[model samples]
Target: MLNTNNVDCCARVRHGPSVAGLQQALGNGAMSNSISDIENSKCLLVLATTAPTPIPSSPAG
Candidate 1:
């Protein structure tokens, strides 16, 4: 027998890839190559979850 009134079902549920999934997909989610490798590439493919925002450059001293 279970008591419904005594139980508090107050909780939030979140859904997404697990830690193991991230490691397997991106190898700790870090760049495996150096920045120089990107410079040498003829083409680039950028993938992101959100739109990129431009940062205002600082005035030259």
Candidate 2:
């Protein structure tokens, strides 16, 4: 359920109250053009600068 509200909060927290991050994220190719575009998209790809796993995490735990 990612939306503007969540993105705003995340951007503010992560980037320190800068809307630039939010705008960049919204304009990113990974982001959907519109709600309809998101609904129609079947495949999702996420690439992060940070790793996906946490310290005590497991592949099959």
Question: What C-alpha lDDT do the candidate models reach, one value each?
Answer: 0.53, 0.50
Over 1-61, each residue of candidate 2 has an lDDT whose tens digit, in order, gives 3654532233324454335655676754233367887679898676664656443322233
The clash numbers for all candidates, in the given order, read 0, 0
Query: Could you give candidate 1's per-residue lDDT for residues 1-61 as a string of tens digits?
Result: 1855554321212112444566788777345678999999999887763337543333225
Model 1 lDDT, residue 44, Cα = 87
Whose TM-score is greatest here? Answer: 1
Once fitted onto the true fold, the runs of candidate 2 whose alpha carbons sit more than 4 angstroms away are: 1-8, 16-32, 49-61
TM-score between candidate 2 and the true structure: 0.32
C-alpha RMSD for every candidate: 17.8, 10.2
Runs with alpha carbons beyond 4 Å of true place in candidate 1:
1-22, 25-29, 49-51, 54-61
Residue clash pairs of candidate 1: none
Tell me how far candidate 1 lies from the true structure as C-alpha RMSD in angstroms: 17.8
